[model samples]
Target: MILDKEILAGLIEGSPYPIYLILGEELRVALANAATLKAWGKDASVIGKRFLEALPEIDGQPFEALLRQVMRTGEAYYAVNDRADLMIDGQLKTFYYTFSYQPVKDADHQVIGVVCYATDVTQLVESASNISRMGLEAVENNERLAAINEALAASNEELATTNEELTESTRLLELSEGRFRSLIQQAPFAICVIRANDLVVTELNDRYLELVGKERTQLDGKPIWDGVPEAAEVYAPVMEKVFQSGEAFFAKEAELTLIRNGLAEQVFVDFVYEPVSDLSGNVSAVMVVGIDVSEKVRTRHAVEEVEERIRLAVEAAEIGTYDLNYKTGELVGSARFDEIFGLGNGVNRETIIDHYHPDDVHLSVLAHEEARKTGRIFYEARYIPKGLPLKWLRFQAKVYFDANGNRLRTLGTVMDITVYKALQQQKDDFISIASHELKTPLTTLKASLQLLVRMRENPNTVLFPKVIDQASRSMDKITELVDDLLNVSKINQGHVGLKKNWFNLSDMLEKCCIHVRESGSHELILEGDKSLMVYADEHRIDQVVVNLVNNAVKYAPDSREIFLGIKSLGEMVKVSVRDNGPGIPADKLPHLFDRYFRADERGTQVSGLGLGLFICADIVQRHGGEIGVESEPGQGSNFYFTLPLGEKEE
Candidate 1:
């Protein structure tokens, strides 16, 4: 069954267990259920702040490091009976808890956040501590009895009085022993005592029997190894060492294999073995105390595996990561971050900021200011590296705040987007230009049709021809624009086919300029080799010549003469179209043939889709040829292309 976000949120909010979600490396508190909020002694106001900021008392604790570890490694952390100091009701109080930090992953299996599950165990810990104190009191009673025995041996006259006192003391000692045994049996953790001489189980609590998966009858008077033989190899030596040296041995999160429930299983435990001494000061037995930590140990192992995968993924993507300190202005970043900003190792925050374009720096500052409230920052701006072209970089980060609402730090990623920005600008320009170009011709066509309709009603023969001509020209303009659009689409789809054949280049060039010659404004001067033969598409070549000549006619209207030249050079033949019009600027020349680019000077308007030259370049490249232009202002311009000289067909 699927549940909506609202239902899921309600479930979390209504849950009795404390739950919260922290996002990003900064550990900003993205969500906190009611139980969690109450435990934290906070309200909804702390939702967008950094976890540490909302609970500043956790500064010296391991929570921040553990959360970050989960975030970095995609691992989960679990602890049982962990101690934490928190500010509750304006008082600093110590609390014990059983909690887990589970890594939250996105669809890509990347760790994006951490969800915390916690249970307060302070009362349970306090109850266990009281039981431990009672056991200590019983040990003290035994010592007192031993001293009393020495006092009686020193004075015979005091024996009778001492006997009375001894009777009362024995009674009290017996009572204390009973309470101690009762507390030990009901203890939350496992406890057992092994005799040092025979390594036999002299005494054990029910908790120990349950922990080892054994019956009281089987282990009560048996050797320690006889009940759980699988553990002898791993733990027997540790127990022996403690007894022989009369020193306590402590083991935390130690793995041990034991036979439980007729099966061998691995379990993790935090345990201690302390030597118990007799009245003569000789070690008589070894007392063992332990708690099962198998769940926590296994959880950490799973988290480590996830962390390995996440590390590999981050490296493969070459993503830049960074962590910034808001107060100190200190920055720590991955190698990719340094490469993106063109900075050296150990780069400071100020040095990196210097690379931001002066005009765009305000954008970053404003984004950060806004993030203080929103808990996130995202902005794209220009970056100018020393002696490098300007670049567009997208900066995304999450803001963190301290408990008092003061900015703490920000964690974020950066990516270079210069190419994407350029493409976006081109797309916008195409939309604007396409709208204007299409509208102009369509408007004229509509006006001409309206005029023709009126002329037909009035029956004016003189205006009829003019109206018909105007309509025809408008239709031709619209058709040209549509054809350019179709060609661009075809080129992008790689559907521009070529039909190759051997033909005389000069013969095609001559017929290609007929339309220009018919204009009667510009003269076509043909020059160079007239018999240069090449194997290529005849019609496509004709299209190239026509486009170049049309460009000269439209851009170089003042130039009365247009020259077409052809030359044979080794295995290739070159075709040139030269005009004595105003030349293109150096900066504009580089992008003259780019799609949707026009070379019209300021205040000068030109007609055409700006795609004629782009199409020409593509056609020439398909024929295994190169195209380029040369020009200077007022010195006119020369556009040329070269085709491979294939062997002539028989």
Candidate 2:
């Protein structure tokens, strides 16, 4: 909308409000509004001229950019008390002004020129003039009536100036309030303004509505207490206390449980209720600020529950569990685990893992690596007890992680599997004996039936003798089965009685060797003492030796050598049977003496029912001695037992 120059000049002169332009660009004036321009000394002539042409000093300033922005956007830019140096009517001046930059737009919304508005506030900067005149004017008093008139005039002028300052101050205060409201609305925290008398909410920020789980329409003009009962209940008394005492009230760890999305969730808050005061120092209202701590509260509760469950599970399962912080090298072990490992002194992340069974150390390292890489760990193995020989335990572990999937720590349990080991051995023994005993008799019976069939098919009565021979063989096999059953029964009943008597170890070994030689497949060699006396059940010791030698011949038929040795120590006689055969695997060596365990894969068909070694161990232990074996796969095996020797022989 373009306007003619004549019409624009008319509007500029007719406008009732004061307007001035002082920018880097175009400005105009028609017949100056006030002629008090010389009040600024030499810049008096500049009032009736264009601002940019009258003040050429700021030509290199950013005023040009400011002018363009206002002209193109038709938006005014304002600043209070801008400090700048200016040349007015060729006189230098230090000035401050309340000012604005505005666009003089044509009819088509095109910028014709830039206009600036400025109100000089330089009177505040001229206070030196008033202070210098104060005392000198008091000393030049003339007639009393004249002086009184002068004083009254001065007082009236002072009142007029004060009123003008107050009006300007009020406008500045309103501007400040507007800025404060903008900042509050943009804040992340909920803000509210309430009336002190009725506790009514007059205004609230957007976040305040979200926090209350309601919309502004639902909450506006409502009693603050009615709209947010939980917050109201907490702050009502607190606000009263703050108002009564004219002090702030603080509440920490205040918890509020609210239903969110149909689920109950707890929020922890820390807040302050501060009484707001009016100009007269009277409490008018209260302001509350709160911080939510719900996530921290929930995390602490979850950790507690997890730790508790871990403790109980480990205790009840007769296991020990541990946790280690990799960063700190700090270790924590459950009480049950400490008791089991006898490491009650406590253990940590760097707890000497070498103290565990040597064979299990590598497994532990592997599990640790897996946990570090994958953020999860799982492992189980047996370890010998720290202070006890032949006592072992099984341990298992898991690794926990952070939300980002980083490994946080390890959790594990240890169980006492010693009894389990013993029970497993007994089961193996029973199965081995049962399979062998049943299979041998069945094989003999089948052989006998085959012989009879042959006899029936042949036209020779002579074949009947061979059938009878097969029947006798079957009967012999059945008798052996019956003997094995009786022996197992006696051992179970603790009735395998030993006739305690002085016996020559050599004589006993010689008899055992003779019986073993009856099989005729292997050679037996005697070693060590020729004559040694042992005080034991002579018959039981003889049985033990015979079994060992027989086992050697049966298990190692391809080998020809067996070594039988008896050595007299201070109070015991040591006996051993050594054979050259495929040695036991390391894993199975510990279980060699377990019942039903055969050294080979054909366990079900192995002879002797896997019980002879177990029985030997039991009898030797009963005689106040020990028995053990040492072997490795593909290597020969050696079985050794010790028995108390007669004092005279020792």
Candidate 3:
């Protein structure tokens, strides 16, 4: 039968032991029983508060750390006779308790919360201490009575009186011894006693037996090594020193390798071996007390390993990380963050902000405002670092807040995305240019067709031929644009094929610009290397020359003369196209040959998809040649390419 949450809560409320349930990494107190509330010296007001908020005094204590460790590792932690300093009645008081923090799992066996069960053992711990003191007193009293009995043995009356007194003292001593033994047996932590002479296990509690993975029967009258031989080598010397010098030995979080359940395992413990003396003041035995802390040690190691891995991954990716304090305006950043901004360490927010492009500063402000509302920060903007070109950076962060709804700090990462941004801008420009270029030709064709239909009806022979020619030119323009796009696609797909043949370079250059010359808008002057021959694809080389001449005509429209020159440089022939119009800007010249890059610096609309120069460069490079352009803002532009001169194979 499945129980409802209310029923389960009711059961916990009636439990004698203190019980509470905390949820999530924040340890929000989901439910607490009356016993728990009373033990914590708190009221019902702390029901929905975080564990630390309800009991703020426990902030620096191990309880919170242990609870968090249980949540992270999904492993339960148990502590016996643990000390806790708490606020009670407007004063800090210390208390001892035996408690456990068990992970609360969901249906899928995933840890979702922690359930703590505690039993206050303050009175028991105090009582055990008092009993130990009384036992020591009883031993001294017994020794004193032994001397008194020996002196009274010479007189019958005194001897009889001393014998009766001795009987009473003997009974009291036996009672104290019984109480001491019971206290040791009932103690929450492990305890054992071994003789100094033989190192035999004279006395031990159930907890000690369980700790060493042994039964009481096997170790009752045997040496400690007989039951657990693996620990003898590590602990024997320490025990011997305590016995010889009558000094106690203590170890905190010491690791020991022991064979338990037929398997060797590592164990961590906080323990002490105290020397016990006899009536003669000589060390008679050693009392050992220990508490296992292996789980805490393992949990800490696991957390460190995870953090180290994350640090390595961040360093490998060169991701810049930062933490900003909202209230104090304090900024802490990684080395990569400084590297991204071209600044040294100890840079502040203002110094970093100074590097952002002025136009994009408003973007970051708007993003931060939105982050305060939505708890997330994301924006992309331009940044100009010292002595470096403009770059695009993507910023992402998460805003944090306190439980009282006050804004805390923000943790974030930044990445350089200049290449991605350039590619994206190119894609957008290509789409816009392609749409306009294709539409103009399509609209003209539609108009020409309509005119032709009307002319056919009217039987005007002169206008009919002109309308047909116009439509045919429009179709050719559309076909050329489509071919340019297909060529770019084929190049990107690595499927562009080349057919090489020995051809005259000067002859190809002359016929390449026949269409440009027919327009009468410019003069195509051919010069240099008239007889130079190149072993390459003749058609492709012609396409390169045509593209360069067309580019000069479209960009340098006012210039009438376009010089196409060739030079014979020993084994290679060079082809050049020079325009007398305004040259390209220095900044734009770098991106002139880039895909979808147009040298329209004046913002004037130009036809074509800006694929001509990119295609030319690709074709020339494929044929084992070089291509380049040299131009300044005011000087006329000069574009050139070179191809190896080859001889025909016999």
lDDT of 2 by residue, 1-650 (tens): 01232344344444332344442244443122221233233333565366455556766766556767776677878754466666566676677654566565422345656554444545422422332242223223223324455555678866665555555555555555555566556555556666778877776678666555666765677777777665566567777777778897755446876544334566765455656676467878766645454443443345335545544554566766566766566676655666666655456534546466667677767877876676555655555555675445665566666556766556555677778887987777676667667777678788878767766756457767777777776777677556666777888898887779877878777766564577567888899988777778888887788778777777777669989887877777789899888876789878877755567646533555666777878888888899998777667888899987754544
C-alpha TM-scores of all predictions:
0.54, 0.40, 0.55
* Residues 45-140, model 1: lDDT tens digits: 999799889999999999999999889988789887799998989998999987789888753477879988776667557756765576567667
Better of 1 and 3 by TM-score: 3
lDDT of each: 0.82, 0.63, 0.82
TM-score (C-alpha) between model 2 and the true structure: 0.40
After superposing candidate 2, which stretches have Cα over 4 Å from the reference?
A: 1-159, 230-235, 259-266, 303-313, 321-334, 343-389, 395-415, 448-650
Weakest 10 consecutive residues, lDDT, candidate 1? 1-10
Among the numbered candidates, top TM-score falls to 3
Clashes of 2: 11
Q: Once model 2 is optimally superposed onto the true structure by TM-score, how far is the C-alpha of residue 472 displaced, in angstroms?
A: 17
Q: What lDDT is reached at residue 287 by model 3? A: 85
Candidate 3, residue 15: how far the Cα is off, in Å: 20
Output the lDDT of residue 81, model 2. 47
